[model samples]
Target: MTGRPTTASAVLPAALRAWLGLIAVLAALTAVVIGIQYAGHSEAGRADRWFIDPTADSVRGTWRNVALATDFWGEPAGAALLVVAAVAGCLLLRHRRGAVLVVVGAALAVVATTLVKSVVGRTIHGADNLSYPSGHTAFATALAVAVALIATGRLGLGRAAGLSLVLGAALVAGAVMGWAQVALSAHYPTDVLGGWCTALTVVPLTAWAVDRAADSRRSDRS
Candidate 1:
């Protein structure tokens, strides 16, 4: 697994900025989370009775089966740490970052989940905010994105055929876990949305930072 450069410092084009664009999308997602929380909680929000008619509540029964698929989603934080260790091993053994971004990004998702859960302090209702950031979704998306990047190449298979396969798998994995969260009533509709946002932001940041670090090492060598 040889890593390639994807940074300006590496003499690669700046098209990689698209990865950074994920940050902007994350900002918008945060705003949406706040909006939904406020809208669902405020007196004005209650008038609509959104909680009584939640998407997550309707499917709570199906979650047992879903849970089996992502029993590991609960353990994503640990898995993510394992990913980091694996990346480090790859670096040591093969001298490549290999999949550091995925591991780190997944680890970040675990952190983001804890932070949101702690700070939000919003409890779960028929389907409101008990789970603002679905760990299941976050880890699922994180692994999906990271694995895809790993499978492609240093440039991460910036090709359509390759990316589609990667993205498709990620979507399926993410969607399954996300839906499972809803079924279990562990989170709300917006909770999964927040998870997606968190994934988009953290995963790419991890990848870019990993790329930037690798590029820096190359420069030092030169």
Candidate 2:
């Protein structure tokens, strides 16, 4: 009996299996964004008021301080610090691919959010600002997604374990930053949701692209 030779696609077939669910996730994100755009458009609508009425501009004391601190992580200086630390960790682990994924994923997520904001024309504080898909939330969530992906690869986690880690990290990061944005009255609740979904949509795709590129290079060398 003769056996077929394995090709690069066969070897890396599972590379994208981990993110199959993203198809559904991407659809859901799209639907939600469209709904928000139709109803909320350039300003907060009933749904935004429903979520923001109780939480927005109500934080105080220790909570306010915490929110401010969390908000800083999404800022340029704090984000740069985090990126440096993450890159350092990846290098220590000798996971050069992971380091690239972190940097590229974060950059892409932030850029995507900015571009969406301009097109969506959503604003919270004033007309001068664009707030749909809160950049801070997207940045924080992107970092979490990057860390989760790197950990998944380094630890050789199974699909279930990796998925759980990614989702959990994304949720925690998104919630923390989303809460901060709302508390600061910097964005509507829907904007935060958009940001979280944007990270989710961007990071995994980035990871898959990175994997494909690496695998292609390996095949070429072989």
lDDT of each: 0.59, 0.76
Candidate number achieving the greatest TM-score relative to the actual structure: 2
Candidate 2 wrongly placed segments (more than 4 Å): 1-28, 35-42, 54-58
Q: What TM-score would every model get versus the actual structure?
A: 0.69, 0.86
Q: Candidate 2 residues 1-222, lDDT tens each?
A: 112212221211254344734543783477356545643355666777887774335588999899899999999999999999999998887777778888999999999888877777776666777888789998998899888777766666776776788789999999999999988888888788888888888777776677677767776767
List model 1 lDDT by residue over 100-184, tens digit each: 5655777787688667765665456633345656667877777776665555553434446555755576678667877666666
Clashing pairs in 2: none
Candidate 1, position 87, lDDT: 67
lDDT of 2: 0.76
Give the winner by lDDT. 2
lDDT of 1 at 183: 60
Q: What count of clashes does model 2 give?
A: 0
Give the lDDT of residue 167 in candidate 2: 80
